[model samples]
Target: MLLRLPTSVSETQEYLTQGAVPIGGATLVWATWQRDGFPEHAMSLRDLPEANTIEPETLGAAVVLNRIDDRVPEVLRRAASTVGTGAVRRTATVGGNIVGSTLRCLLPAALVLDARAVILEPEGVTETDLAEVVAKRQLLLSLRWNTPITSNYVKAAAEPGGPSPLVVAAALHAVAGGGTLLRVAVRSEDEVFSETAAYHGDAGETLSTLWDGSLGRLPVPARELVGRQVTELLARPGGR
Candidate 1:
């Protein structure tokens, strides 16, 4: 397959005029080709300068997405690294994680961190709150956040060979009041994709539930674990 790459969207469109196919991530490109037809020609944004850097003003010195590896914060980098196997990581952009319009485990930490999404559409660049973007499907260009918080990721998948998330959660400490923020995102594929939130005084039990739920061993609902229900249950000592 021939690849007609561009550093700018304008350049990509130019190639399209020349009968080239357009793509962002190669995986998406390949998927489109397999599901549809040979792109005739393909355009990729890999050469763009915008895809490389992460700005701190946006996210309280959040780590750059490309550099999101073991060297970065454990929770954030682990989320990035664990997105898929090694090959997928090598080519997949951070924006791809959020744009798929599915519930993801990594993004909740950013929501808790008060992150914003930096989108560069054909119109121009615009920023929107993460929550707003999650409410619908929009092509995303970049992601931004504004907090320095401890974060964690949890997931529950089926058996030994499934791609679906039975349940997933990402927890973050809030920057404002030193409180804990818990974001639980779930995807039942054709069923639903939703995010629920709660504040935690002590996140230990919530974390336990998230960790276990990701592994399909959860006994508590995400709302209860992150909400007041856990506290009420604990108050009774031997309560469910």
Candidate 2:
């Protein structure tokens, strides 16, 4: 029932492709029948203890987690709730989503926050922007960064799974002491898997738009919507 494969998501993908139903982080499919008709081959992410943490040195931006209870940001933790169901979030790993490209709720926030991932390849350990890593094929060992901006996440769920609000958006600004540096990221599953960014020089407009969009009623382009939402966040009167 217990089988510990290589820690890499790609290697694990191979097993899944061969009809191995994964029971580890980010995936908890229950297979009625295995490829070889075995009861189960429980894959363990815990076996690879090295793949842990969001890497605090990368601070204020990188919020990685193996379980939903780990030290990730509140926005990200709330984002995880938008995934499939409680069972899925319970087993899903942020690293698995980053490397495997499954549930992507956390990515827009990470990308908007300028988060990067630290990967462990056969060659060696290296760092890459999270967007690029998601674009390419690589084994994500850990994600490292800091989340240093007041931000918001927006997504609209439809009634009975309708067509609107397959959209998601995120906004982030640098921390105080010249926090005008802003990054707004948007994603629409209805559209292609492209993450668009809007880097506005003024934090005021950025925060304003971000808050408005996150709490807004319309489905706007990820870029423009994120901009509006972020603008609102920054424009708030009390040093928001």
Candidate 3:
């Protein structure tokens, strides 16, 4: 396969605007690629330093999954560890993960993190909510979030190494009036449900309500898993 290597962001943007696909780690693209169905033009982002830096409030799109553990939030790290084996993590990138899977894999944790995407488009650069970019599939440059809340995640799968049936994430952060704010996200098979509100001494209820609204009649097992994780998140340092 022919590859275009751009030495600078401008050159990379030029290639992107001309309909070239941007490749970070390229793990996802190569994994699902069919015979003779590869992109006509693919530009590698490895040479672009901006897409690989890990900052306090920003995670570049080309950051590999394994490096996320020490550089990113705890909840995000946990989700990244579950993507695949160690070798896969080494080659899979944050940007590829964001575009490859809708919300089931890493997006749930990112959602609770209040993440936003810095996208490099053909026209120019723009900042957008992470979920909004799900449909656009634009070229993401980095991810940014302000509030680093205490949060945790839980996933229930039918078998060992099988697909997760239910995945839930909950977070607690400071709000006005000296109270806490609760943000939760649930990733089911093909959908994602989320809710955020000022903590009024009722987090489990909000989670259950969101589940019921999104998927009618939450099963006992799913409820228990979500409850345990939410309980842990609330008990974390400075939570509630």
Q: Say which candidate scores most in lDDT.
A: 3
**Per-residue lDDT of 7 in model 3:** 70
Candidate 3 scores a C-alpha RMSD against the true structure in Å of: 2.5
Q: In model 1, where is the ten-residue run with the lowest total lDDT? A: 57-66
State the lDDT of candidate 3 residue by residue for 1-240, as single tens digits.
568887777887799877887776776667566644888888877767878878767888888888885566777778888776799889888888887654347788888888889888877778998877877787888888765667787766556555565887777767756777777777765577777756556766655555656433456666577667777777666675
Clashing pairs in 1: 21-41, 21-42, 59-145, 155-214, 156-214
User: Best to worst by TM-score, what's the order?
Assistant: 3, 2, 1
lDDT string, candidate 1, 29-131, tens digits: 4665688778556655566555555454232111223456543334456566656666766665665555552435456445544567765545555788766
Per-residue lDDT for 169 in model 1? 33
Comparing 1 and 3 by lDDT, which wins? 3
Give the lowest summed-lDDT range of ten residues in model 2.
57-66
Candidate 3: misplaced stretches above 4 Å? Answer: 102-104, 158-165, 202-218
| Model 2 Cα lDDT, one tens digit per residue, 76-156 | 655666766666665666655555544466676566556677664545667888867777745565655565455566675
What is the TM-score (0 to 1) of candidate 3?
0.87
lDDT of each: 0.49, 0.52, 0.74
RMSD of each: 7.3, 6.5, 2.5
**Residue 184's C-alpha lDDT in candidate 1?**
48
Error of 3 at 96 (Å): 0.8
> Model 2 clash tally?
32
Ranking by lDDT: 3, 2, 1
